[model samples]
Target chain A: MLLLVLELAGTAVFAASGALAAVRARLDVFGVVVLGMTTALGGGVIRDVLLDVSPPTTLRDWRYLLVPAITSLAVFWYHPQVARLRRAVLLADAAGLGLFTTAGTTTALALGAPVYTACLIGMTTGIGGGALRDVLLREIPMVLRKEIYALAALAGAAVVALGDRLQLPAGPVSVVGSALVITIRVLALWRRWHAPVARGLDG
Target chain B: MLLLVLELAGTAVFAASGALAAVRARLDVFGVVVLGMTTALGGGVIRDVLLDVSPPTTLRDWRYLLVPAITSLAVFWYHPQVARLRRAVLLADAAGLGLFTTAGTTTALALGAPVYTACLIGMTTGIGGGALRDVLLREIPMVLRKEIYALAALAGAAVVALGDRLQLPAGPVSVVGSALVITIRVLALWRRWHAPVARGLDG
Candidate 1:
């Protein structure tokens, strides 16, 4: 139940980011909805496809589709307010990163993916939507350049995988693991942490 | 057997395009290979996923993975020659578009997806990889703006779907449909046939 709530919350936040991106790009209303839905659901769909699950849970479930669509609509109509919530959006995005990474790791492990595959899937799930969003808007994916984002997700996924291997209770493990990711991401933002760049190149 | 051969041919051409794009971007060796592989296999994987086939055929089969990897290696080494083959690349890409669109539509029909869904899937298979490649390079997808590119693929897919509805043989239908798409695409390029632009806006 807690996992389910976390998943929905993550989707909503990701949808907001996607909608904002679409608005910035001056996309039509239809484009905004398309981008938002893709951002919220594309990662999970990619994971399910990799795992060989049919029909993608997001496509099959009405609630999953509805959440992102409604959220995008809200953004379309309330741009000024949504735009003003920059700090809140960042915090929400960090929370989403934590939730999605752990959830993806646990789901992939349950589906028999190897630990490494699970970790990759987790990171993909956390960052894939935003990547898709940026790509649709013709921009470089922020995850590839942003400070410590994908790395934070990977760490969270690793925690979940380790906890599962040790037969830890899933609930506590997920909470602690997600919290660790959130803490890392928030601190990275505050500290202006950045991944190393290739020297003597225009990054 | 024929389908498999056609699929691999199309994948090779797409991989070449992707590798060329990576070289133009001045990406490192690993990045070039990654882009090439994504362009070659990404479309089919996406179609399979949407059709609910798990593990994507490209991921499951070693040959599918190898074809792109090899093609990318060749491109990385012979980029100057490859770049000079722009005309040849255009011809090959048209062939790929036709083959993939028909193949994708047929596969989706065999999977019991609705005709409309199958048509969309076919177009996706034909264009999805290139769109992904462009997005990764931080550019607007050519399919959305290029001269009747996606429309040509859609027309071919529709032909295949119609033939299937009339109980035609899959082999002949595939050949005829793919040929039609290639002819249309090539003609569009030669004659400068383009979709109408929305006037009075920054297109």
Candidate 2:
């Protein structure tokens, strides 16, 4: 039940982020929905594919599709209001990232992926959608740039894998792993922490 | 045997294209190789996942991984010469497109996807990598813009699906469908055919 709620909430938050990006790009209505849907579901789809799970869970489920569509429409209609709530959106996005990281790790582990593979897959699931969204918008993915985003996902995924290895309860493991990610991300953002840039590259 | 050959050849060609894009983007060696591998294998991975085939064929096969890596290295060293051979690269890419399109459509059909779904997935397989490469480089994907690129893949996929519906021999059907795509794409390029742009948008 908690997992279902987290899944839906993450989808909604990511969809909003994508829709906002589309608005900033000044794309047409079709593009807005495309970006939103992709951002919300792209990671899960990729994870499912890597795990060799057919048809992808997102493709099979109607609710997963509908939420993103509605979120896109909402963003298209009232982007100004959405834009004004940037801080709240960022918090929601952080929560979504944490939830998704744990989800990805657990799913991979359930499918018998090794600990290392599970951690990587988990990070991919958390970051894939946003990376795709940025790419579509003709921007270098923010995750690949200054912020400590992908690392946070990676760290959370590692925690999940570790918990599983230690034979911890699934529910507690998930909550703790996700909380670790959320705390790190929120602190990074508050402290204006940044990832190290490549040595020769101009900022 | 033919499928394996086609897959490797297509991966090499797509990897070259990705390496070229990385050169244009002035990315470092790591980025160049990463983009090349992604461009070479991204489509097939997506297709396999949608068909519920786990562990993506590319991930399972070392040769599939190796070909892209080698191709990327070759491009990194001989990019200037490769850039000079633009026409040759285009021809190779066209062939890769046809092969990937047929491969995607047929696989989906074999897995029992409906005709429309097969066609769409085939087109996705044909174009997904290039789209991903462009996205990573922060450029609008050529497939989504001008030229009859994706349409050609769709046409080929449609042909294959129709052929299957008619109970045609798989070998001949695949050959004919792929030939159709190559012919159409080559003709479109020669004639400078362009997909219509949005009426009021700035070109």
Candidate 3:
């Protein structure tokens, strides 16, 4: 029940972000909804596909589908208020990132994936939706170029993997992992942290 | 055997196109190879995942993995010559699109997907790799903005689906379907056909 609630909340916030991006791009209503849903669900779908889950959980579960659709439509109708809450949205996005990374790593471990592969899948789950959104919007993926986004995901995933290896209790381990991700992301944002670019490009 | 050969050839040409793009962007060697492999195998991986094939054929099969890796490396070394052969690469991409569409549709139908779903999946398979490539390079997808790319894939997929419904011979139907895709693509290129953009956005 807790997991379901967290997932739904994550989906809602991600949908809001995607819908806002679509509005900024001046896409029509249909486009806004499509982009929003894609951003909300793309990561989970990719994770499920990698795990060989047919029809994906999101595709089969009406609740999973509904949250993003409703959220996107809501953003479409009341974007001005939502845009004013950009800081709130970013914080929600950070929480979503944390939740998704832990969920993905835990799921992959349960499915008997190797530790390293599970970590990578978890990171992909946290970052994949945003990457897809940027691609559709014709922008460089923020995870690749800006901030400490992907690293935060990776750090959280590694914590999960380490906990699994040490035979730690799954519930507490997951909580810690997700909290670490959220904390790191928030700190990075507050500090304006960025990863280094390649050296000597101009030369 | 023939399918394997054709898929490998398609992978090679697609890798070449991706590598050329990376070179033009002045990405490093690692980035060039990563982009190339992503372009070559992304469509098939996506098709397989949607069809519930575990680990994807491209991921599990050594031959499938080897083809793209080698092709990408070759393109990395010989990009100037490959760029000079741009026309040839375009023609090859048309052929690859046809092959992937037919293969994806056939696979989906064999799995008992609905007809419309199969057609859409086929179109996705045809265009997914190029879309991924463009996304990585931060460009609007060519299928969305340029010539009759996705439409041609859809037409060929429709042909395959139609033939299946009519109980036509599989081998000959596949040939005809792929030929139609290639012909339409080449004609679109030759005649400079383009889909219409949305109107009155300037106002």
Each candidate's number of clashing pairs is 2, 2, 0
Report lDDT (CA) for all predictions. 0.84, 0.83, 0.83
lDDT of 2 by residue, B1-203 (tens): 77778768989999999998898889988888999999999999878768867778888999999999999999999999999998888877888788889999999889877676677678778888888888777687766453578768878998999999999977778888888988998898889865432232242
Ranking by TM-score: 1, 2, 3
Residue B35 shift from truth in candidate 2, angstroms: 12
DockQ of each: 0.16, 0.17, 0.16
Model 1 regions lying over 4 Å from their true place: A1-45, A48-106, A112-123, A126-130, A136-138, A142-203, B195-203
Question: Per-residue error at B20 for model 1, in Å?
Answer: 1.5
DockQ of 3: 0.16
**What does candidate 3's lDDT look like per residue over B1-203, in tens digits?**
67668768878888888777777776655556667777888898788877877656665566665777788777767766777788888998999898888888988888999999999999898899998888788888878876689889999999999999998976677778888999999999999986777899989
What lDDT score is found at residue A184 in candidate 2? 89
Q: Report how large a share of the reference interface contacts model 1 reproduces.
A: 0.27
Q: For residues A82-117, could you state the per-residue lDDT of candidate 2 as single tens digits?
A: 888988778878887888889999999999999999
Over A178-200, each residue of candidate 3 has an lDDT whose tens digit, in order, gives 88988998898889875433233
TM-score of each: 0.63, 0.62, 0.61
TM-score quality measure for candidate 3:
0.61
Q: What is the lDDT of candidate 2?
A: 0.83
Tell me, by DockQ, which candidate is best: 2
Lowest-sum lDDT 10-residue window in model 3 chain A: A194-203
Provide the TM-score of the second chain in candidate 1. Answer: 0.96
Instruction: State the lDDT of candidate 1 residue by residue for A107-172, as single tens digits.
Output: 888987767667767877787788888877777666645647766887899999999999999788
